[model samples]
Target: MLDLPEDKILPGTTGPALQYVLVADEAFALHKHVMRPYPNKTLDIEKRTFNYRLSRARRYVECTFGILSNKWRVLHTAILVNPDFATEIVKTTCVLHNFVRRRDGLNCNDELLTSDLPTLPNCNTSRPSNAINTRDLFKKYFMEEGKLEWQHNFI
Candidate 1:
């Protein structure tokens, strides 16, 4: 249902405009603009390391969604309203969520919210070579320059 343009370039990259990409799970296919974790169990250290870093970065997004869902119970249940209205409700909730978080500074306990939240659905699709290459580049970056101190423990 998400109608994203295939040609959109990602914002905020320092040099050269990279294609806008969505970080998703293995269930989804990678496109020129979408990056997913390397598939299967036989991945090498570099791939595993990449997956770990991606998962760590993805946790923040998941936590934000969890906070939004927790703060607005309506997101937990199926809304009977029109699709447009539902979109408006979600948008309003996001704005309000940011406002509240800014003013109150994340009142919810991180452990409780993150651990208890359900995983979001992935967009099922096939992997394009361009996306695979991009993922590899990101993986290399994480393995080299972008690694954190505690990342070795996971690998």
Candidate 2:
């Protein structure tokens, strides 16, 4: 690990100093950051920012885990045959969950499509296919109406 010079520790110079030290790496900033010493207050701010970004990033990860738990019941020990099969079971379960979710017609990134972001029904959990279809249609209608209003605003 290259120790940055005293001059490099100053504000506005850290990026260049870090880049110089980690010439080939895109994540020199991260390495430099982790290495740099700071007071408790500064460290607390960094920690808070890290936590906020982590929490935001992890929502998707949590959703994936939730999908796994709900779809395959991976939390159940019945799926585990042995230690060897455990890895395969986890992978297979994720694939199966995704496959079944798609097959059941849940569209990821489908906009709420309402003025105030309408409260969507928790239909993806488990409901009749027809119920899901009906929900989709209702949502689509509102989405179209919202789009029309949005267009009118722009025009």
Candidate 3:
């Protein structure tokens, strides 16, 4: 984490301090700065609704990864290069993806993006109560303040 000053606030926030967060899949851990979807078998309406919305949002991330891997064949196979160099290659491909999209109005061929990559089996871990509360807050926000008219269709 960057040693940003406590007073350096994120834009559009009331407080002076805020930590950046990563939205990830349930295969990853839920922490103070990481948000993930509720379990697949949740029956509660609130949890179900939250999962639907979060899944819709997460689709973009999944698509981007798919597109990146498809466009860069090296990403499709295990990189034999050093870890640092591999990271740079992925980063450079992302930059190039954006450049091509902007310059040529190119988009990912979604139909060709396959889901052949193996995913890690989700390991159930007891999450901290605070992380659950944060997720609840977001769920409430999406249900109320952040709701859109078409969102009802998904529910």
Candidate 4:
């Protein structure tokens, strides 16, 4: 846990506190800012729907990285340069990738979006109640007000 100062935690925004979280896979540890899908056991409709939605978002992210790595071969290997230069390299690649995509369009044969979902070992660690509650709230929202009509079909 980070021993952040109080001011860092509460930035004094005008409106209600917004919870920003990362959509991660099973390999990541769940926390207030990281949401992972529930275990693939005893899943009810709500859980299945949540998993489907989360997986769909994760797929887009994976596909983007796939395209980037295929285009910029430098990203495939470890970047041994200074941290600042590495950041610039990544930013530049993203800009160039978008520019090229807009101009030439995707040639899937050359820039194939390959996805390899790794099998993660079972994690027995108990997550904090706050994190669990946050995920539950999202699941409830997805099942109710925030649901897309076609989301049920995917589940």
Candidate 5:
């Protein structure tokens, strides 16, 4: 994760302090900088709406990776190189992908490609209280001031 100082905050329509965060699926653990959906059971409208919004954000991430995988075929297969080298390769491809997008923009041939990776077991660790509080704050904001017009349809 990137080191963001306390002063680094995102502008929000309504909220105390909106810090940048990464959206994760249920398989991952919750952290102050990582936002995951609320548990599936016993969800209120606020939680449901938050999950939908987070899913929408995750969809964009998936789509961007789809574009990256399609443009860079090496990403589709297993990279047998060292971990550091693999990281560099992925980063270089991302830079190249952005450069190509800037030069050519989206094309008709672009398609959403998903990779089939082995699923890891769900994280069973207890979530930190601070992370839960942060999620609740965002949920409140989404339900109140930041609510979207079509978000109600999902909830």
Candidate 6:
């Protein structure tokens, strides 16, 4: 449906550089194609392969959500009185979680992650639960598609 020509797809440069990209759009089967021939050889390879790699590295986001929802269970018993207070509570919870991890120097077992926390069934995303793979995603995607994050270089 995009009808985008091969020349118009401006590849993204932010975050991490990637290589091959394979998009399987059932809605627009014509768009279900790969984007190869990256101009920046130093950054990536082919689009299909790059997509495969990127898919894995983004798994941490889900894991973070799971930890937040399961442990807090705030999603179920939400305090829907004041929007601002609710937002503040969420932020505080996240900060406390990070502080505990840092104070422990990440040495303790990740038992807290798997503890008897409340599990929030539906967060927001429209995709089905089994649509994506979580474990080994980093291994599958990052090694090939991960670009060197720019730490100091502004240009």
Which is the leading candidate under TM-score? 5
Worst 10 residues of 2 by lDDT: 19-28
83-108 in candidate 3: lDDT tens per residue? Answer: 88987998999998788778767653
Candidate 3: which stretches are off by over 4 Å? 1-19, 40-42, 80-83, 107-111
Alpha-carbon error at 37 in model 1, in Å?
A: 1.3
What is residue 21's positional error in candidate 2, in angstroms?
22
TM-score of each candidate structure, all chains considered together: 0.70, 0.36, 0.73, 0.76, 0.82, 0.38
Model 2, position 128: C-alpha lDDT score: 44
In candidate 4, what are the lDDT values of residues 54-126, reduced to their tens digit? 9998888888888898889888777899988998999999998889878886653546557565678856667
**Candidate 1 lDDT tens digits, 1-155:** 56565553233334333555677666566776667788767999889988887777678677777778888878877778999999999999999878877887866453324445345667665567777777877777677656677888977
lDDT of 6 by residue, 4-66 (tens): 445221233232322223432222112123321212345333333444434333345446756
Least accurate 10 contiguous residues by lDDT in model 6: 28-37
Can you tell me which runs of candidate 1 are displaced by over 4 Å?
Answer: 1-16, 79-85, 108-126
Instruction: Give each model's clash number.
Output: 2, 0, 0, 0, 0, 9
Q: What is the C-alpha local distance difference test score of each model?
A: 0.72, 0.40, 0.72, 0.78, 0.83, 0.43
> Over all chains combined, what TM-score does candidate 3 have?
0.73
For model 5, how does the per-residue alpha-carbon lDDT over 1-155 read when each residue is reduced to its tens digit? 47666624334653367566789899888888889999899998889999999999999988888878988999888899998899899999999888887788766367768766677788888889988888888888788777888889767
Top candidate by lDDT: 5
Clashes of 5: 0
What lDDT does candidate 4 reach at residue 38?
A: 90
Better of 2 and 5 by lDDT: 5
Residue 76 of model 4: what lDDT? 79
Q: Give model 4's TM-score versus the native structure.
A: 0.76
lDDT of 3 at 40: 74
Question: What C-alpha lDDT, on a 0 to 100 scale, does residue 11 get in candidate 1?
Answer: 33
Q: Give stretches of model 5 more than 4 Å off.
A: 1-10, 13-15, 78-87
lDDT (tens digit, per residue) of candidate 2 on 1-155: 44445523223222322222211111112232221111126434333333333344345655556556655556434554776698688888878867876877786543221122234442223334543343233223333431234322321
RMSD in angstroms, all models?
Answer: 4.2, 20.8, 3.7, 5.2, 2.5, 13.1
- Candidate 2: C-alpha RMSD after superposition: 20.8
